[model samples]
Target: MSRLYASLFYQKQVTEIFSDRSLLIYMTVVEVALAKAQASVGVIPQEAAQSIETICTAQIVEQLDMEALVMASEQAGNIAIAFVKQLTAIVKASDEKASRYVHWGATSQDILDTACILQCRDALDIIEAQLGNVHQTVLAQAQTHRNLIMIGRTWLQQALPITFGHKLARWASVCKRDLARIGQMKPRVLSVQLGGAVGSLASLGNHGSAVVSAFSRQLNLTAPVCTWHGERDRIVEMASVLALIVGNLGKMARDWSLMMQTEIGELQEPAGNGRGGSSTMPHKRNPVAAASVLAAASRVPVLMASLYQGMVQEHERSLGGWQAEWLSLPEIFQLCSGALERTLNVLDGMRVSPEMMQRNLECTHGLVMAEAVMMALAPKLGRLNAHHLVEDACKRAIKEQRHLKALIGEIEEVRQQFTATQLDDIFRPASYIGNIQEQIDAVLRQAVGAAD
Candidate 1:
């Protein structure tokens, strides 16, 4: 929780949104909104609501002692208790009548939960924008490399040929799904939390529901059917979605790091400004962004799991479960936002070496094309017979250190089955990549539709 490495591991914008000062400001905004809502339903005097609003400005909230508030929170069981006390005192100095109505019927959970929702709204906006940037960058890469042939691996060994765009399109499709999830989750997670003590607004009499509606309207958040003092699905869902996004980013980073290996050299993270530098070696170009993303990906799921465990709260209000979220949720947002930002950077500046890809594709010396040759011969010989023949040729090709195609040319069955011209076409990398363009196009069309 120390901010020593915050700039390196968390997005600066998101970090500020979850800052201590921002939290105080959000809590103050909630109290102000509550006052105005109560007044709208005639639960409190309009003049009193006006005075509370006018007195509790950002400037006034800034004057409150944060260090004292933190110290008091340790003894008070939660920050909102101390925060409400300070806010009431501040309003008392300006107008005595307004002080009486400060945080009038609302409890600590209501204020704190509403403030957290407000924070999540802002944090989600940043994440959505970053995801959009990454999605667009991936689409561009897919479009640009649609036909750039490369070797596709299975179990880390060359299996067949595929276009690099096919790989990028898969990332694009996942990003589109992530965007859709963000859209679906906003309404549920952005709902205002307002319940007087113990999940019911018993103190507000008949005006409780009205105040809830008005408060939600004032904040531009959805009002739930009832209070969720003990229910924690919304918070958990937000963490789940964030974890899902981080997981996808980790997958991309893993592939990128693998491809950036010196033996592969098919791709590289962008170089400049002393990035990807080595501390001890002069010839190192590390996948720094990818590594950062992977670190976040590894860390966020465990944080998200804590939230899931926090879901089993006691009735009305939790003893320890509810408080667990205070520590887990913001950290989840911070790590997820960091991962999204790093992914965008990598996608934007990634270096794709079509030449190296082609070279690596051929490094196997037609061994990669064995499947294509086998399929071509499958019709002449029985399927099992063709598999055996190609299997034998593959071994001979490796032992003789010669191309599989040349070795296959010497086989009597292959000579009788096809001409040299046909065999030449069988080994072409592009020829073996099946329907990759159509797949990429389908992904791109879905991405465009999602944008619309």
Candidate 2:
């Protein structure tokens, strides 16, 4: 009724970035850049660029009649047409001659698409900062728990032993890869769109290419090989990357939620005065951050599919497909921002209990360490024979309610081959961790190398 995951965890920074004011500001940015770009090629006077730039602030755009603009947009089939008229009117009041060239050679799609790219670039900056924080938190977790032994579960059941740091290291590796993807895609996705009417630049004639190049330079964006009026792959690719990054966030949420369960109790979300609480149950400190992240993960795919669907534009310009991106991109960015913030909060406050981890490790009654005990005897008893012997011992140990090590000594073949010290060392969970630190180091090094 109120909001999913509640308004308590709502991220204001995300909401502000997609606000009506923000959108208008970016659209005005595109218009000012257009004027400045035209001036660079002698299409518009330099004084006009200066005049347009002076009044293009968000504060100025906020003063215009947005409701009237939206009402006017319905007849025009889009908002940018009415918005450009408002800009022209405002500029006319200040300097009449400059106002005539306000939206000179650009179509609505050019202004709208370029404005969307500007917003997206800013949104990615916020996302990148949050993601970096997550990377640092995960890396710290791995370094802190490098030797914290825990049970590794498969199919929701204990399967083997692993160091807690190893699990954290895996998440760190995922964050690093996600950052790399964002960096690679930003250049391609942040390019300006300046094809007029039908991706032809017909109005500007010989000066179109120069204006386009200048527009990109003025805005500090890349110049595309050609116009992308009907080509929607850039937005689609960006949506795909955002969806993938959120999927990784969902993975972390699922793992933390499971580990926080009473039966497992190996990990916990941060405890606070109004965080992760259940209204009726006093015993319930629900993993709300994880729930929020998981909710976002589940919801984003539908929006992403819409972006993908928007890719099917017809001819050099599309009627419906171009309209689809207006809302979907903002929604996706907002969802990712909320999810990223909650995830970072969860990581910052997360608590790992080695005591509980150790207790749970024994819940399997030494069955999880089977691989370790089995390996130690493999060389002595021959691989097949040793596996058979340990497998038989495991069954007996389970039935007799005794430890695996207790039963290993009773087996004649095992007793004949090894002494008490060998069994003692082999059965320890510490012995089974096996190069986890080295693996962690390698992952950290690889992430650092990729960054460099």
Candidate 3:
């Protein structure tokens, strides 16, 4: 992580979870857990396991020369190799007999992969909690604005009337699905990776399977049906899910930033001291949170792709492909966490302008209601004739700089079909938002049921 942009793009808790020191600690945890599991399965002396566990403390891990370990990893191909050496030495210093089994019957990839899985479990917990917060905020916004009328845009142009609640409910539905995806993925992705040297734990003799089960129990992780040393699908699946989450956040950010435009001031990101400000433009309150989220969204897909590419390993373990995930996966988690935090911040303090939404709805001079007008006249003029007549009135309204209601009223055929009061009702934004409350309620029911 860079000191320059880390604060801007990384969440603190997640960053700490993926930090080098934290990684070292997690690796130590795997080493300790492995010893205990081996001892439990009668593969190692319980006294030796106790020695390894007691010696491999956070203090011992912190005392190691990280720079030297990292430099040694340059030739070792991965940090796990160098890390195991230091860990062995630390255990040896306390008890010579115990040091013999520091990493007995295990490979470097086992320690590294299991440690990374532990890290992911912690990181995902934070992400899930933050997502729950964002989802709750979205639900609250949807409920509050369920009846607030606004013009729905299509291809960047006003199309028809809709409630702001309807827009928020759509966002809420995606969040619900994202939450579900995370839940479903955890079981598969959070399993233990315990294959030795090759895919089989050949070094452990008859104790491999038993050791794996005990190790999983020790770490509170799932014992997979088979080793995944070469199978990178679980890791890639996690990266893909993280990318999906950021993509959803990006969509929401794009909409919010567009809505915050000066010409369309229907929404604003949360304002605070020095928040969303421009250095030169004193009048600017940019959508900084949305911009950050969009930036993360843009970057996560490529990182996830690299993980996907890394799936093609040479047999049991990869050469360069497995190492590729050493950085990419952490960055994905970091960026995904940052995006979630930014979204929650925006939702927490965001300002919604029903008045501005109402004003913008009329900016088109009632052209947005043409569909309603057409439908109303369809019963009398026939669907095709009504569509043609309303289409003509819309063009005339734009060309003559007149309200569509006025232009439609002047149409001899339209006047013959509908009275002024009926036409007035057709132009009301609220009148055209059909079943919006029901739609919003349906989404809310799903959300509320999920909470239960």
Candidate 4:
């Protein structure tokens, strides 16, 4: 593999799934199916199955140079033509009579499509496991800060008070929903394909259904209801799901990265002993982990477009569209899995600055508590009238650079409606975060219930 490809998540040690185990399982399934098919047709002795199995166990790359073969196919303007040549050589060396039955009745699409599905399954497992890790981390954070109060912003301005627990709970809920979506789609998306050329299976004769069943059983995959040679809905669905997962994780990363800014240091990515660089500036601690998650998250849409375009397969066998997907789908899965896993790492070691959060809330000198005053007076003055009153107080607080409490004391309407003692109760930031505990509990309940 090229250095660039090797550096990617799909190609690395952490989850080198698509390139290694997935490919091996796919080829093994295809070769075994061919052997079983030959036995059914009486073309090869049943004992020959062991020989075919043995050959498959030998390293596929050792027997045939896949890199050269793939490149040769591109040079020749053919699909699997090079693979056929290489497999023929391997079989010729093994046993001539049994060799003819190696890829009997199978077309390029059969092997390629099944292999892609296996890759998808492997990627899904890795992504799900990483998401589960993220879910647990978020849950723990939510529990830790269930009562910790902070300002909530809307349209880039403070609107009300909220708990850090509420923020973490919202993230957990999004991931929980996506995890459910993945579970719902896995069975349909990972189903196998065994139809021969033209998707009719006509070459397999009357035992077509039995052959497909046996083939699926051996591969530990679900056989499709019918040949989906040109039906690209499942591929599109799976890729879209992956894109959604990345987008959600991106939202989380974006928020955390922004909060880690020097001016608004309410949070920080986990800092290690040798975490970040300050090549020119001595007092710099860059948010490299947060930046990495952000970069990974940003790449999802373009990868997803490849799958979207592949949805428009040309005909019964779309050579161009299917070939495009063969390259794009695995890359999409790779990027998503990488992003998800890294995002988990970020959340697991994330540091919360409660003092910083409180300081940011006070940056505007208690202007954020205006909403509490509005709600407190709503029952007495009516919501619309109280809103306008609070609006005036907020403008004065900003212009005169005065605290909201001072502005309220200056307003005659505010003094007439409430006493200084009453003002203290309304100004409490923690009071405005209504039902945060309830919501956090609800999310934990859902995640735990689903797990059970």
Candidate 5:
């Protein structure tokens, strides 16, 4: 599929997650030995872990029948079963000792949960790095455009004047906060899941903890305090965090998409060579990149809600809830990862139309400066009286289709409140942006401190 189609609405995230094959191989080895080594302890033979470990590292995706595996997983009622069946064949073909050790003393949950964690962790690494790059790119734009003044809107209408840099700074600040949230969640998100049959690791006895520590250490994962067979707070927390990131990216994409509208024309994503668009509408260059980010972000919350439901797992395990996770967790990770990747592209290639911004500042027919004029005239005319006078003059200007300057020049009350010279200062959008740069700086410093 084209990049546009994938980013917008059609994406095969499930395929992306398992298609790596290398990650799958690692997951199979880790989950299998984690159960095997914990089960027989001194009797299972340490060589089993070694052999299983070596074979896992050697397993190749190119040699396997993925479609068949997926279909068999459905028949077996789980993916882990299919994975073990295939892996057992591979190991048996090479080493009988390793083949005997494969998937020993483990239920399907043990392998599935650990494998999911490992996959989720890999996705997180990619997301964290991408978020960092996005943050820096937005910060650079914020600094570069710090003085480009434009109108600030609330509720789709102009509220006040603000610099383009200030807006970019806000974007950077939101992204930085997301980065911090992800950092706070890493330890928990990366925690190892070694819960055996009933989650108490009752099958492993005293060596359960040692084996867990070893398993986590070998995989560079954080070992959970106890089995979480029935506790899904960690997964829920991860889903929530990812959704938060999605929300941030969505807001950014939505705003940029709005700014790129023909009527607005204040911003644009770079039009690169071979960039795809409508063939018939030669003049139309849609914000496809931004649209992709927004589309990916929009699906994240629904996927995460399923994970939230999974948090209500019953007893030692809820096949119902846990089964939901098998579909939901990977979907969440893949959706979020796709959104982050698209968002980074948007930030990296976004084009700022400072000239257009200045032009659009006048698009509102100087109404955006109404607040500034009111403030300037408030002390002179009394607050309520000043509001009434400016309100009347603004209405007249709109009706007559004339500039506020011309209408105010003819208004006796406005003339009495302020001179033409003073009115010019009041109408200056740049002069009206109050301490915007300072606010930006403060937000940046706070983000940096929190990140540090």
Candidate 6:
């Protein structure tokens, strides 16, 4: 289920994708594809290729002793060494003659890199779908509250009045751009890795290019222009995109957390019997989903840096650089997956308090509408005079604990410039939200097109 965080808030699909079992399965898959590629060119017997395919099942791959395999991998410099050994043994048991062609004409880097790409392909599907869900959730919020008035804050202080839908639609627009970035990254990151030793394909001689083409077809991946043994740009780009996704989610969480504060009380994450409960304080409705999303966001940048560091590989092969990716890539995918799911859940069930938003708008005592009043008086007085008059009124209103609207009416300059009804209109929250409906329509139109 896509709801991978419902039970205990742990994502099982992400765990399974990068699991030890999955590693062996994809490695075996790569080896079998290579065998099939070789067989297509008559470099190896077709019977051996067929046998390799039969024994590469998840059940058979799990039979090897994992403890010894891990120790051997530490000594042998790569897991593929111990893994191919075990795979050769398994093939030998079924048919002695077929064992010779298990991982023919391929380097360990080829097997591992292609396997990791396969895993990335799987992770991307999940992320893209979840991104669509987030886009839809934000779109729904915008459409539902398109005209609902709220105070927009700058530097954590009330600055002006804006529709809640306008705020949500801005996030939706950002998410639409994120989806575009993911689309652009897909082709770049999904290319196959099939180069032999030193990336020259010298092991397969003249048949190297043919086998590479066939192998890419077998795995349903794009053929790379050349071997990416030392080129780690695609991997780094993917990590960067995931980091951006988490960062954006974190921003939303931070806003939600702040709005849910007791003083603000304009929003709340969905509440259930045990969903966001406090251990001691009965009144505390904690932001559990935001906590996970923010934590992932906080840590993803460092993980992305590790992938960027991996881009500095040694010629045709890397020692420490490739090793950095072994743990970092999987960790990036897992953290991003969990963060995406949490953000989706948070948006899907969150509650909004329109009344509270209205109340909070009045908390500043019409200071949020200072710009509106200034603009209405700008043509009557010069721009500087209007600004000074409104600015003086604001200070007086704050000092006397009075509304700016009422104080502005008493000013001679403001009274000469505008009538009582005009002054009242200038202070209204809805009067200041310019073109918000048009913007909402435009954002929703793009979102609908994206869904198609």
> Residue by residue across 1-452, what tens digits does model 2's lDDT show?
13554353346676676777888888898899899999989998999899888977767776789899989999999889899888889889999988989999899999988988888888889989999899989998888898899988899888888998999999999999899999999988899999998888989979999999999998999999899999999988887888888889999999999999988888899999977777898888798889888887898898888888888989999978878887788777777877889899888889888999999888767777788877888887788888888898889988999988888888888788778898788778888887888889977787678434
Off by over 4 Å in 5: 1-17, 20-23, 32-43, 60-68, 89-98, 274-276, 411-417, 450-452
Tens-place lDDT per residue, model 4, 166-245, is 99999999989889889999888887787888888887787677777777776778878898989988888988888888
TM-score of 2: 0.96
Tens digits of per-residue lDDT for model 5 on 67-149? Answer: 98879977998777887788788878888876886766566776667777777777777778878898888888888889899
Give the alpha-carbon lDDT of every model. Answer: 0.91, 0.86, 0.91, 0.77, 0.76, 0.87
Compared with the true structure, the alpha-carbon lDDT of candidate 4 equals 0.77
Which residues of candidate 3, in runs, are more than 4 Å off?
Answer: 450-452
Kindly provide the TM-score of model 6 when superposed on the true structure, using C-alpha atoms.
0.96
Task: Extract clashing residue pairs from model 5.
Answer: none
- Candidate 6: C-alpha RMSD to true structure equals 2.5
Give a tens-digit lDDT track for model 3, residues 264-324: 9999998889988888999999999998899999999889888988998898888989999
Question: How well does each candidate superpose onto the true structure, as a TM-score?
Answer: 0.98, 0.96, 0.98, 0.93, 0.89, 0.96
The predictions' CA RMSDs to the true structure, in order, are 1.3, 1.8, 1.3, 2.4, 3.0, 2.5
Model 1 Cα RMSD, 1 decimal: 1.3
* Candidate 6 per-residue C-alpha lDDT over 201-228 given as tens digits, one digit per residue, 9 for 90 to 100: 8888898888889999999998887999
User: Which residue pairs show backbone clashes in model 4?
Assistant: none
Span of 10 residues, lowest total lDDT, candidate 4:
6-15
Model 1, range 128-222, lDDT digits (tens) per residue? 99999999999999999999999998899888999999999999999999999999999988989999888779899989999999999999999
